[model samples]
Target: MSVTNSFDQLATLRAVLLATPLFAVGLTLAAYLLGICVFQRLGRPTWLPAILVAALMLAAVLSLTGIPYQEYQQGAAWLTVLLGPATVALGMPLYQQLPRIRELWRPLLFSLPLAAGLAVIYALGIAWLLGASPTILASLAAKSVTAPIAIGITQQLGGSVALLMGALLITGVAAIAFVSLLARWMGIRDERIIGFALGLNGHALGTVRAFEIGPTAGAFASLGMSLTGVLTALLLPLAWRLLTLAGMSVGS
Candidate 1:
């Protein structure tokens, strides 16, 4: 083969190699690992949560590569599939705090629904008030839930998957970053309340944040995140139905 032909073959092979599903998955994992490495090296500051850093890095990769989302999703779906098992694992934490859960069951009954409703209300309602498109409103409805459930809700409601992912990422990151500051500002010193706030507003991210605070808070956060997710899942659709009936739904 000619020297130029061998060079051309190498370029073609490299392009084909990077296009695989495994490469996509590897890219995601590498981005996250890189973020963690950076965080560790930088002393783990609040401003640079590993996931957010990873997401930013992944976005850079996607933008630079010009690869379509569909191709990336093919590999990323592997991660997506694990959300179900992770959700089930959340019950273990809840079980450990069963006594606290019982003791506070009364307030929880009142508070959880409010938490779930408000997350959606603050997100979608504000968007609606600001004249956001119907698609935007629908996408925001599940912004507080964990990603898997949120994505399911978004898809079912005819919202954009990309929008749902973006909203969830932003919401989670904000929750982790601001929850502590907001707690101090609001005079919420109680760990249960702190956990509830994190779980209700942040979902999985909030739960992770809660764990960082304390185990009791982590348990409450798990409970709060699960309850909020359930409530949002049920209520968002019902409310969306009512809005549609009232002729408020915008075409997707």
Candidate 2:
């Protein structure tokens, strides 16, 4: 009777795991931890960051298990909610770097808008060249922006939030690899420059990488990410409307 009871309890546990969101959350955390372990074991290669490893692991699990992404996202969405708080927490670093920011205010003011605009333009241009649909082009527009802001932009443009998320991840990894390699090639050792580039090009992931370099680099990365998000949010929509109007005028 005791042996039968043990088997029954195990069956109940398995049923509970399959029925609840905890399984998804647990799986995600486990995958990330394993990714970190693998990343460390592999000597922390820039091309294979922990996040990428985690993502690949998750992808493999889902593929192998035949789990629908929508089902997985049901539980995973809880983690996405934390991005807002995480972003707001950057204010501390921003405050700490105020003096440096003030010292570089002039150049920052001049370069930020130009850099932000270029980021959007390049993404849209590439997607257009590939004959992507308008929805995809819009989704790619905010790939370099952080998640919360990117989601809003994609929704406003009638793009898929799902696609935007994927683009953001790809952009982050690509930006890290690109910046690291180019910085090494050009012998650009300034953390500020590196951080700013990462933030501008990679968004949240870039800021995380910057923090690994040092506080100053991390702070600058936060500044770059915040300013880029603001600029892109405010200007991209307006620019899009104008271009849309002009296109309609031309069509008529």
Candidate 3:
């Protein structure tokens, strides 16, 4: 009788949590806040940054509670909706630095294609070398862009959007969390270089991480992200075609 009653109570609680939107929203905000606090208390180190901590905590909570991703997303969607506006707001600071940025436009034009092309080449090459399936490779080809854009590209390429999104999210987080350390270790100074690399490789998560370093880094990162996004969108299809052609040539 006691065991049966405990199971009944647990089921009741689960249903209640799933029904309440606040449950998911509150949990997400709280997790991020706690992550910030923990990161600060640890002396603001990069290895365990606040964003990463918050993400892990949220993941752990969801896993432990057995909450479906859809259920959590219901509440988190409100916050996710703000991402675009927030990123756009970052452009103001970049705008203030436009004179400096303008001076680099010539370099920017030359570098943009190289950066975008290399990103796609490396992603596809590594995946191919690892012997990933064509579907998986197709999905991963656009992994550097934001998820929505990536999904669109994946669809055009006959890949699963779901698989693209999964890989996309993982790479975004991993890049944001570790790229700075990697940059420093590799002796790549210059905020512009760091910021640009972060934006190109990390996307939104990298932009956020760049802000933490300094305003200048943030501005450069925003530029890198915007440039890469436009370039990637415009060139990805052509790049994919060439890559496939090369693959066919090599195989033959």
Question: Candidate 2, 81: how far from true, in Å?
Answer: 0.7
Q: Which parts of model 2 are misplaced by more than 4 Å?
A: 1-19
Question: Once superposed on the true structure, which residue ranges of model 1 sit more than 4 Å away at CA?
Answer: 1-15, 18-20, 248-252
Per-residue CA lDDT of candidate 2, range 1-252, in tens? Answer: 999999788778755665778998999999999999999999988778899899999999989866778878886888888898999999999899899889888888888998888888888888889899878988898999999898888888888988998899899989889999999999999888898888988899889899988998899999999999988999888888887789799999
Cα deviation of 65 in candidate 1 (Å)? 1.8
lDDT of 2 at 73: 84
* lDDT digits (tens) for residues 1-252 of candidate 3: 999999899989988877877888889889989999998999987566676788789889889988877778776676666666776676897997687688778877788788778878888889989999989988988888765456567888889865776676677777775777788699877777677777777777787778877777788888888777777778787777887899899999
- Candidate 2 local lDDT, residue 184: 97
lDDT (CA) per prediction: 0.84, 0.89, 0.78
Task: Give the clashing residue pairs of candidate 3, or none.
Answer: none
RMSD of each predicted structure: 3.0, 4.0, 3.4
> Which of the predicted structures, 2 or 3, would earn the higher TM-score when compared with the native?
2
The TM-score between candidate 1 and the true structure equals 0.89
Identify the candidate with maximal TM-score: 2
